[model samples]
Target: MTKHEDQRLRIIDRRTLWNGFINLEQITLEQMMSDGSTARLVREVHDHGRAATILLFDPERQMVVLVRQLRLPVFLQGESGYLIEAPAGLLDGEAPEVAICREAMEETGYHIESALHLFDAYMSPGSITERTSFFLGRIDTSKKVAPGGGLAHEGEDIEVLEIPFEEAIAMIRTGEVCDAKTIMLLQWAMLNRAALSG
Candidate 1:
């Protein structure tokens, strides 16, 4: 932030509210107003660190590999928790590329030679502290070293789905594919399909 922006807010205290699978922090601070005044505010930030997500596409087949798995949070919201999404996982102190590759092997059983780095994004900035690195990778069936069904111990009973590009995109339109990360990656592929094929 700029020097003028620095005058905007002051942090009074920061405390941890909860720390488990996810960390929650309460920040007591004040923000400056346009009228040269400050407003006190307390904002809670859910810190889950960062993550990496990779969209694996087959240029020749014009298909993508996704994982269908249950999300408890979604289920608790009275919706079907089975979500189709790109391979993703927490960084866990590893580099984004390394994390994505590990998650890919664990979830889909594919060993990728390399992946193209896309961008970094905040899934939900309103209250979450997660910033996910995005990537794209090209793969074929020949690269499958094992049956891609996810790890058993992690409670990951992932159902690997390989669908045509058009079908995957259509699923988004009809609400079949509702995961935000998956949707974003699919749209990106659509825009860069020709380049990817080359």
Candidate 2:
């Protein structure tokens, strides 16, 4: 094994606990203690694959486009199922930029002119095996290629909202926009305001 692989944690075996649209894998593992002892543990990990999210910014209009859709799991927990988030989707083997652009068009009806890659993050590393690539893409009102509401087959009834950047940021403090990726990109945009305006 490589030097990095010689860690204190070792995987004895791993098996799929549930496999479907999303997969769950249960792992049997052991970790060397601080005092040189070993402890075995079992962990169940949910694999949703990698994803990409893009915040479509219309600098000329000083607005950002976001999507609100029903997220059943979130709804089941007693809160509203509808969530406001940046246009995002699983990579499906595509490059991060390509996937984000495609998702932007599909969910927001806006064709991105240029995309600036921001960063990648694991949204829920404790249980999920999904790392999402974040991006900022420029767009204009004229970039609307279609009346996008997401794919019908995918059961996505998305409501696209184009709100002023300032208001979008304010929504974060009001707890109106709670999606982590959206909050990250919005904060980044606020911090990079000068660059965004030509």
TM-score of 2: 0.95
lDDT of each: 0.90, 0.90
Per-residue CA lDDT of candidate 2, range 50-125, in tens? 9999888888999999999998898998889899999999999999998888888899888886678888999999
Local distance difference test, candidate 2: 0.90
Which residue pairs in candidate 2 collide? none
RMSD to native for every prediction?
A: 1.8, 1.6
On residues 62-115, what C-alpha lDDT tens digit does candidate 1 reach at each position?
889999999999899999889889999999999999999999988999887788
Q: Please give the range of 10 consecutive residues that has the lowest summed lDDT in model 2.
A: 189-198
Q: Tell me the deviation in Å of residue 141 in model 2.
A: 2.3
